[model samples]
Target: MNINLNINNKIYNLQVDVDEPLLKTLRTLGFKSVKSACETSNCGLCTVLIDDLPHLSCTILSVQCESKKIVTLEGLSEEVKIIGDFIAEEGADQCGFCSSGFIVNVISLKRLYPDIRDELFIKNYLSGNLCRCTGYEGQMRAVRKYLEV
Candidate 1:
């Protein structure tokens, strides 16, 4: 199937298998940041913003995303740079494998709830993303700093 995908603010028309996961298609197209740690959607490493909502790319079909506005971390808005900066300053990006997905999801959360500052709420919202390193303390600090700003 030939599908048109608006990814990272650019339009891509590519031929893909009907059942191909969006993660594979994106990666094949050189969007290497869309990691695929867990193909079953258990890990949030494949998360992407589809029409402004975060969705697991590994579990979504390429055909299903035809014509949708898909935003990867590379396409993140400039306004959300604070989140990235905070993460870096806090040294939260361990292994760096999950950073893209974490940052993308954080951008979605911040856009959805600009005034959300509760630690529990942030933790609960980001629970889907699992990072074995850093113990999540640094990531939590980054989120708190970003929200407080």
Candidate 2:
């Protein structure tokens, strides 16, 4: 079946199965920035903004995404660049696999809780995402920088 996908403010006609996960469809459609790690949703690598909220693309059915505004890392390139600059300054970006999802998650969190500043809160907030590289210290630094901005 065909579904309407609103991505980065542009609409596209996506022909996909209703049960297909949004992540698969996204990757097939060229949104490769949406990383796929642990398709069970344990890893936040598949995170994407759906209707302005961070939703795990690995678990979300493609049909549910129809007519919804889906924002992937490609769409958030400017924000990711800003975060990347901060990550660079903090010596954070390593492996780069989890960067996209983490950045997207941070963007969503910052928008949702603009006044959040508790380190513990930030740590807990980012607990869902797993990064094998960088050891999370750099990740924390990047998050701190993002909050400052």
Candidate 3:
């Protein structure tokens, strides 16, 4: 099947398997930042923004994303860079494997719920993304800083 995917502000019309995971298709197309630590969607490492919403690429078929706007970490806007910078400064990115997915979801959360500034809300929102490094303390601090700003 052929699908038209608008990813990172570029349109790609590529042929793909009907049952192929979007994560594979994206990585094949050079979107390496869309990592897949767990192909079963248990880990949020393969998360990507589909039409401005975060979705697990590993569980979603490439064909299912036809005509949708997909945004990976590479597609992050300047506004999100502030968050990234804060995270980096706070030493939140250890191992850095899950940073991209976490950042993508953070951007989604900010866009979806700008008024949710509580610490618990931030923690709850990021619960899906599992990070073995940094212990989430730095990440939480960065999130608090981002929300404060």
Candidate 4:
């Protein structure tokens, strides 16, 4: 199928397979940040923003995103850096395999709830994104630090 998708504020013309996951489509288009640890949406490593909300790219079909706006980690570099600085300072960023998805979700969290300051609420908001290394405490601390700024 041939479709036009608005990704990272740019239009892309792509010919994709009917059953191809958006994760693969995006990687094919050089959006390497959209990685996949589990294609079943459990890992959240393939997360991307669909109309400003986090969605597992591995579970979404390329054709389904034809008319929607998609934002990958590449599109939100500055926001990523804003949060990443805290994550790094807090020592939450480890291995870096899940950084893209984790950062994307963090950005979404802030956008979705601008006034969020509760630690529990922040934890629950990012429950879907799993990182094997830091065990979440560092990430949580990083988020708290970011929110304070």
Which 10-residue window of candidate 2 scores lowest in summed lDDT? 87-96
Which stretch of 10 consecutive residues in model 4 shows the poorest summed lDDT?
Answer: 140-149
Error of 1 at 71 (Å): 0.5
Clashes of each: 0, 0, 0, 0
Off by over 4 Å in 1: 77-80
TM-score winner: 4
Residues 10-100, candidate 2: write the lDDT tens digits: 9988789878999999999899999988999898999999999999999999889888999998988788888889888888877888888
lDDT of 2: 0.89
Q: Give model 1's TM-score versus the native structure.
A: 0.94
RMSD of 1: 1.3
The Cα local distance difference test for each model comes to 0.88, 0.89, 0.88, 0.90
Residue pairs with clashing backbones, model 4? none
Which of 1 and 2 is the better model by TM-score?
Answer: 2
What would the per-residue lDDT of candidate 3 be over residues 24-143, giving only the tens digit for each residue? Answer: 999999999899788987879998999999999999998888788999988886856899899989999878999888889988898898889877888888898999876899998898
What global local distance difference test value does model 1 have? 0.88
Query: Pick by lDDT: which candidate is best?
Result: 4
Q: In terms of TM-score, how similar is model 2 to the real structure?
A: 0.95
Model 4 RMSD vs true structure? 0.9
Clashing pairs in 1: none
Q: Which pairs, if any, clash in model 3?
A: none
Model 3 has an lDDT value of 0.88
The TM-score values for the models, in the order shown, are: 0.94, 0.95, 0.94, 0.97
